[model samples]
Target: MTSSTPSSPLLPAFGVGTFRLKDQVAIDSVRNALDLGYRAIDTAQIYGNEAAVGQAIADSGVPRGELFITTKVWTEHLAGDKLIPSLKDSLTKLRTDHVDLTLIHWPSPGGAVPVAEFMGALAEARALGLTRQIGVSNFNIALLREAIAAVGAGAIATHQIELHPYLQNHAVAEFARSQGIHTTSYMTLAYGKVLADPVVQAIAQAHGATPAQVALAWALQLGYAVIPSSTQRDHLASNLKARQLRLSDTDLAQIAALDRGERLVNPEGLAPAWD
Candidate 1:
């Protein structure tokens, strides 16, 4: 149950995300990611893949001390009584005593659960050594303010959101920066939509990197942590190499221009009033 320092750096610039991968797919993907030198692995209760991810980690033989594992509390578990227990279940399924980072998957659906209730519980989880850090994902400016009020900004580790070349999410990103909260860019590739963008492809050709790398590097250059997922080892390896891909100012600007606020992860009735 021991964890790294609370003030340890924000998530690594690169990691593997297990959003939809399940069963053997999840296990193999996580195993490949670790084999390719990836230490940070992101999973969530809603993904239905925690067990598989756990199995992969156990099989990887990588030291737990060397990994940064992140999991999110699903909406149904936001209640004060359920938050910690649900996280304990996640720990069990993840086959670990404590995760490096834990996030509120989304703001309680329909505001049915107050931010104070769940955030307080999440903070309590950290105090109890159930998790090393706590954060919120898919929180807009208004929700971020409420969360900060519930728990100081310092306790809110990162605001993970759907961000990419097509949907820059400038408003939320800017707001999080002002409050000193880090942002993690999920779907940074826009679910492969951005990879086909002619601009991105051209940039990739110029750098001799894959389009996926170009997208990831752009986000990383913006100081946001990225967790792109893949089932193939070659693709996984190529994506990890994005950490070393440096984009020119011109490349950044071109990609910036591609932003049209094209968000792809919004769910009906569950989405917050976005910024």
Candidate 2:
């Protein structure tokens, strides 16, 4: 079913997440999401789905400005020369002149180019008009501070990180809030684990929502943008209601108490000291 939301410069806080989807699958999934009223689509270099995501965008008939597309440069490609080229390649794949936002996938330490250099290249890309907004993903409090110190807040916009009821992330969330930095909560549903949690289910029953909606609502209430992925049309359709589900103060606290700092995809070899 197609859907849309009231206009808010702040993103919908609910979007499509394409992480493990492959070529043809990504394309089909994206088209489905678009037809279903999802204006925001998230992709990354590591996801191996840019080409498919691009294809879907190309055929969706959605105005470029209307759709908020986000793509990222992999940690391995954070070098000076690689930065622009990688972005160019992503643009080529997405079939767009520019993306809504381009992010540094990881703050790899001692890889090749310094974070400052990568951030500089990102700023240059923004100036070049290849990307409207530039930001970072998988960044922690220290890296957030480093990026702020190096590039300033005006350049780096949001920090995309793993946040869910199971991983409260209050520290980073509060810090970003104070810095006027918005957060995009990837894995907002805890990769489907939240779907099975008795607590989440109970909360969902109380609000007449799915468990995913409850978890997503928890993060949204905490002021973090959420992107919950679902290959199933039913789940995707139900997830949109997450934005409308407003949990109470006590409910929010109960969810926050579930934090265990669990991580889903670190790949420390790709980013040493990733924790």
Candidate 3:
């Protein structure tokens, strides 16, 4: 609920991610999330549910200025000519003039499109008021370097990645921090895998919080923004409460020991060489 500065457009520390959600399910999930005090929502063109998300936002009756919405452009549309048009289509589907933040969903497969082309196009999108801020997802240290070269680090608002206890991705996160680009942790729960981990479960018990809350609190404590998705109303409400669950240094260290570099979202041909 903080204000965005000219330099760093604020991304809420916590938000709801709509990845595979679709149709009425997506709409209901978003509506429930909004009703539960979630002001930030994350979606993407590949998710195929922007319209539902937009409709939910519209039906929520929340003022546009009161919410933060982020969406990504798929890799196929990374070309300079396609980027803005795709974003315009996304805006039309999203029922907004501009999203708070927009991102390159992933690096082009086999380097089909250079980072410079898309990054520059993304900057153009911002200049044209299609989006208020620009960023990249699934980018490694090297890819981030290329993005920075395309558009100075100051122009990039955030670098979202799959960060969790199992796959800390410290190298990428550390480098991004050095550049002053915020990191958003997508799939912070490891798609529910971490929710059953004994270490996370134990920490949750000690704090009287759920394992999901422990994982989210751990990411937040590390200065990373998290977008955890869920369809169940109770789960969504409980996850939002993670903002209030502060983990102790001991708890953090214990969770840190659980890292195994277990990445769960790498797709063949689309993922970059990870750090």
Candidate 4:
């Protein structure tokens, strides 16, 4: 959000999302992202492309410290015994000693394990220097409260979540802001659906930016860091330009009016919304 926030200091306002890209494609995307001035890279073990991401980061020759690298530990491996190993696997695949940030992929709502367990484990990993910062993803306010209480001092460095104008997560976002925790916004593009929205297209025409950039600009303006994924050269190039698209107050209000509570990436079996 502000320049003083945790997420703000670690990366630029926008970056690249590499969730589904894999093998040579993923590797190529990472390299291309670096070349395009994308200082942040979001990846996760569940994505199955850590090695490809790692290879590209290594070859890009961009100093490791300059690039903000992120990876996540899947919910399946959050058990005390499996946590470290999972993080190790991530490190190995990422070709880095430590990641700028690491997140819990999901809370595994219907699963038996407690949130305290993994959040505690994530704090421990942070203490052990496996990651510069640690947090959770796909967790609503209740889960976030649990995560915050569980981790205590290492209290979530950030909360990666599915946030778009449609699914305005105001309460949790407000809570995060109050506590000085940051949010990592995934699926900010509505998984390509924004490309077809008439309102977005109209706004794009007015701003002379693609719908993709308009969507990203809206999210970034609201203070959540964004990661939009793209495989094509032109899409990636245009997506990065979102950082430069500044919307006026009226434009922002139009986007705010566009919210219809449409959530595109809800994890099945999670608790109800944090109203």
Candidate 5:
């Protein structure tokens, strides 16, 4: 776990993601993950599974203090007046008083909302005990700079982005590093695409591990926190073991050569200009 500052919330290196999951599927996935020793969970307002995730958490009987819960505010809620209120609404759905981390889901749908306005409101949310820390997702270099200007560098705890072997996103990752902001690599497995790569498969064979574990270990070795999602209990349990699958320099290099800038999360209007 790491944080940009002393007061920043501690973010675990691995967690379960609830992106496309919903209803009973989300509940079962989250419950299975928690039961398999996963202590962190990532969800967002747009995911439409916050309440299900909340229910899974309650049913697991995991103490709130031992878990790190993260949720994101959608683009519609980026306005200064709406940010905090929407987060409160998210809190209600999550069944928690405060989230470990809260991120702006995207950069205000083409910057219609100024970074300062929402960042200030998010900081206010942290100050008011609604969230322990604040961060952003899908922000590019320019947008990250604007956010850093709105709140000091240390205030932005983590930058969640679409990163994996195919789309390494070195520039944004480097910039985040220079600012001391932790990077969360969403889609770290490239949504199962990379799991079939010959290079990844070879590495998996050499390590005697699953391809999913190899991909996750690569991201973990690069210092990025990963929240890989899986509905199957076997996959969830297997993915958690990635933390222990250390990659050698040669293995890392083999996977690094697989980078081809193949991004998979770009949307028509919501995605920003990528770095």
Candidate 6:
């Protein structure tokens, strides 16, 4: 795969995420997101819904070239020999030969797989045309450093992380930015938690937007790509409008003050040492 120009955005500024969405529900959600003008879709091997997402993509009637699909390789498949084959399986399930970007879903539990092994394998997968770009998710500053060392900064495309107002993760985001690795904010709405925050709601009311839109806009304005998932058509459509909702300086500062380092996705045995 060819490298992207430096000026090109690493990923879509706004996209749809498919976590916990399954079966026909995943299909209808993806299909509806497409109809509402969402071009980027995020999924994972562990999500167990790639086939459903694939079916939705197939039935959407949208040309493949117009879409940007991203999927992750589970930690169990990080071995050098296993990575590519596993990604191939993901491709078959996603109904595509190549994904726009492929990421290490999380660091190997307890560091069982060395960073070089999986990063090199991911690089190989990109070279083999299985994915156009490669990246890592849920990595802290130290892990990001190790990932950059393993793959070289230029080989990395982005760092997908849990970055909502409540869990700003400034250290990791700052490190990624300093190295030119774009940050993709997952759970930008904080699993609906931020949607109910008084500050977020106030900002939304002031902008005539929903709290979800305000949250997404805050992340986008900070130059981090956001994937906010929704199963509702109205919510999906409203989320996309965030690209048009520009927050004022006060609004941005107010949301920034809401950061409390509250992380919502840490699995006891799987989470890394956060930065």
Model 2, 4-39: lDDT tens digits are: 122236455667999899977778778888989999
* Position 248, candidate 3: lDDT: 87
- Tally clashing residue pairs in candidate 4: 0
Candidate 5 per-residue C-alpha lDDT over 1-275 given as tens digits, one digit per residue, 9 for 90 to 100:
11222222477889999999999999999999999999999999999999999999999999999999999999999899999999999999999999999999998886799999999999999999999989999999999999999999899989999999999998998898989998999999898999899999998998899999999988888888999999999999999899899888888888878889999999999898887
On a 0 to 1 TM-score scale, where does candidate 6 land against the true structure?
A: 0.96
Query: Best candidate per lDDT, number?
Result: 3
How many collisions per candidate? 0, 0, 0, 0, 0, 0
Candidate 4 global Cα RMSD: 2.4
- List model 3 lDDT by residue over 1-275, tens digit each: 11212224477888899999999999999999999999999999999999999999999999999999999999989999999999999999999999999999999998999999999999999999999999999998989999999999988888999999999888998898888898899889998999999999999999999999999988888888989989999999999889899888889989889899999999998898888
Candidate 6 lDDT over residue span 79-165, tens digit each: 989999999999999999999999999999998999989999999999999999999999988888899998898888889999999
Comparing candidate 1 with candidate 4, which one achieves the higher TM-score? 1
Overall lDDT per candidate, in order of appearance? 0.91, 0.81, 0.92, 0.82, 0.91, 0.90
TM-score of each: 0.96, 0.93, 0.96, 0.92, 0.96, 0.96
Query: Considering only N, C-alpha and C atoms within 3 Å, which residue pairs clash in candidate 3?
Result: none
Model 5 scores worst on lDDT over the 10 consecutive residues at 1-10
**Clash pairs of candidate 6?**
none
Alpha carbon lDDT at 62, candidate 2: 96
The true-versus-predicted C-alpha distance at residue 120 of model 2, in Å, is: 0.3
Q: So what's the TM-score on candidate 1?
A: 0.96
Candidate 4 vs 6: which has more lDDT: 6
Q: What's the CA error at residue 131 for candidate 6, in Å?
A: 0.2
lDDT of 6 at 267: 95
